[model samples]
Target chain A: MIQAVLTAEARTPGAARLHAALMELKYEFIRLMRTRAYSLSVLGFPLMFYLLFGIGQRSSAAAQYVIAGYSCFGLGSACLFGIGLGIAFERAQGWLELKWASPMPRLVYLAAKMAASATFALIVMGLLIGLGVTAGRAHVSLAQAAELAGILLVGSIPFTALGLLVALIAPPKAAAGIINLVYIPVSFASGFWMPMRMLPHWLQAAAPALPTYHLGRLALGVFGLASGKHALEHWLVLASCSVLMFAAAWITFVRSEAKSP
Target chain B: MSATAPAIPAAAPPAPLARLREVTKRYGQLAALDRFSLTLRRGEVTALLGPNGAGKTTAVRLLLGLTRPDAGAAEVLGRDPRSSAARTAIGAMLQVANAPDTLSVREQIELFRSYYPRPLATAELLNRTGLAALERQRFGTLSGGQKQRVLFALAICGDPEVVFLDEPTVGLDIQTRRQVWSEVRALAAAGKAVLLTTHYLEEADALAHRIVLIERGRVVRAGTPHEIKHSIAARRIRCRTRLTAAVLRELPTVTGVEADRDGVVIFAHEPEQVLREMLPLDETIGDLEVSAASLEDAFLALTHTS
Candidate 1:
């Protein structure tokens, strides 16, 4: 009976693989949604920030620019806290040990997290655009709204790669503190909270090097609010940041695996 | 305590479902597993009994492909442990296995179930682990024992042929620990190859077909619990008697005697002879009981010899 049961287990490998990947993705999103703190902060921060800073302004231009800027902020927060702190906590609890030991493909685990991060970013972008055209009364056409959503959704990837780097470098207990210390200040200087042109000259010079700045510029470009002549340069910087961060994360993870329980 | 149930004999000799052949893992200058070898066969529970830092966790990690051995091969069903085919047939309940606090018990099981081609039914999996009633509870809300039961449920949900349980009952209350032991027995009875690593000797004695005592990354002794007990060649005689330690010590083959709250405990290689001599001399003798030296005694003796 035992032999028969063991022999009967492996059916079509392709079907099992596909189903496993989908289940992983589905549950990851479900879990993320159920987390009130994550859902509230990822969605709440930008919504709250937009309401406080964007509404009741003298002209709709400030409202329009802040809407685009806050969307980028929402997108980065979702990736950094969701993927960054989530992985560090999981690794600390030895949860990754169990997942690694399982038969689920490594790619499936990574893809599920990336997809969840993107989906969270998408929801934030969608809500912000809905409010941008209505309550904020920020003159956003439907075509421009679609373009803004496209920028933020595609923008989640570069931030997700950065999140992986945070997971690798930060200790679990101190991960949130470390990410916030760097993320918030960088977000401020990168024009996530406001336009960089009004910032001190030193921060404006450093803004171009930061990935958040590149992403913010991309989002603002949707509303004809971007200043720089070369739009493609922003994509190039974000892409380079993603590649470098991913490579560093991979190397650190491989080296850490060599010295484990 | 009595062994839970009689051991089932495999039909002919079974091939090892997993094996670590002379695996040596090192951390800088310190070697975690020094040419260590272990084997797991179907329908058998092989307990890797050792103290902390005895390389027990390293052995499990090597078999699970969580870490590669520095010098030797780790294989499951004749395939590299890191290979997808090999891992598909295996399941592990690690020391600190956990999931997101927000996920419900049922959701965690569902996610793990999807990883296998032939996972156990949701109801059966819950029922077997006594987790059906609490299936909808969030993982963070469960008590410590309940959390452990959920981890156990996840380990076997995959219908795995080879299960690695590293310290499966650590930090659990006695009742919950026994429950886990019985479930582990059920897994073996169903013909799965179970490899358990634990520092608790009675746990091994209760559930294992074989106990391998490890120390300093080496197998100091390996045998059935009965065989391990016999190496000491001594029995403990506990009785409610008026006999003094000095008097009991004079009995034939009496190696040592000590006072107990109830009465006296006499250690002797030939317990029957000692009892016969003590019964006639002490008219108040009652509650006489003789049992072989425990595995703890065997382990200490072997560690000393090695």
Candidate 2:
């Protein structure tokens, strides 16, 4: 029995690879759950912001807008801080080196992080939707709610790529602070806390350039709460940003490896 | 030949499990490994002994394919170390590594085991490493010794044919150090090739089948423990005597002397000659002790001159 268990052919290569990927996902999930401060902030901050600003509004439309805005804010924070700061800290700790030495595929490592961020995005969306329905007096059908949830979850990808770029470029010690600096400014400018029309003219014009702006627009468009002009263009811009950031991340990763051992 | 003569097949020596042939690795102006070479074979334990910055870690990194060598070749299981096939056949415990803090010991082991196509049973691994009782404890909460043992367990979880342990017991209490040493010995006894690196001379002498002493990116000496001890041809003589260190240094075979609380300790090339001369010079000499030089003494002598 031991001999059979020790043989290399005991399991198919494909099955073993899948098992390894799942294990990475499981462990990453466990790590995120155990870090109470990070989890609470990523999941709670946006909900708190929504409750404070959206709850007392007499206008249901205003409440709906705040819901859409903060949903983008919540998911963006999850991807940016979760992937960005997490990777930087792991590299500093030499955990990345250990993982590279193991037989675990590099893609699986990144995929696991992305999956965990997406899970958090779903949780934040669920909580925001619940608060919007009960306290904010927003009316939405089940289909619309599911569609908005899907959009927000999918919108997290671009931010995850951006986070990876930050992780690869910044020094680990300064990564968290730098990410926070970037997160707040970008979220505000992108109208994730308010509507783009309320900002300065120049800031409103530049809103479309930020991926968060495009993501929030898409979220609002799902409920017919905002203009749907060039919805495809919004997706195109976000997708293009994702592609560019991913390429930059890959380049930075290769360069760092060459610079080190 | 007569038909009744029995045919005898010629025996062949098995290939080395891992080899570094004239490998050279450099960082900026400093050469971490300069034209270094070593081989590891099945069921053999080879210890790379060196002081800090002696390039022992560099050599292990090159062999594990974590870093590429500048000049020559390194192979594991007769294939380039970078190949997945070669990597699958080996396991390594690096000098600087820690598992995820939130995961329990068993979870960590299970995760690592899933990476390999064939892995040892988790129960057996925990039992062998004496980690069964601490199976559910968080990795971050474990003591330093327990953490090292967990790393050891991960290194062997894959049932690797060759294992690399880079300074496995650098900082540990004596009892914990001994526990890790015995586990390493057990790995070799199971017919696996083991390569260990450490600056602790006693560790190398106690656990290694062959010791290779490295200094400044080159192997200064390589031999068995007995051969290394005899190579120096130095002996130490300690006795409670009235002679001062200055008088003892003047003896023919005595090269150095130091006065201690016990008496005077004499370092001599020939202990017998020193002994012959000592008794005649002092009538009150008593409680004499003569012993061969230890590996530590040999290590210092070799590294200091080169």
Best by lDDT: 1
lDDT (Cα, 0-100) at A226 in candidate 2: 70
List candidate 1 segments past 4 Å from native. A1-12, A58-60, B1-12, B171-175, B236-290, B304-306
Candidate 1, residue B153: the lDDT equals 86
Q: Candidate 2, residue B208: CA error in Å?
A: 0.7
Per-residue lDDT tens digits of candidate 1, residues B111-214? 89888878999899999888999999999999888888888888999899999998888878998898899999999999999999877888889999988888
Q: Candidate 1 DockQ category? A: medium
Checking candidate 1 for backbone clashes, the offending pairs are none
lDDT of 2 by residue, B1-306 (tens): 698897666654334899889988888788888899998978878999888888888888788888888899999988888888887888888765556688899999988898888889999999988899999999999988888888889889999988999889967789889889898898888888899988788888999888888899999989888788766747888889988788888888876676768787787889898788888999999888888889987787678742
What is candidate 1's CA lDDT for residue B162? 98
TM-score of 1: 0.88
Candidate 2: what is its chain A TM-score? 0.92
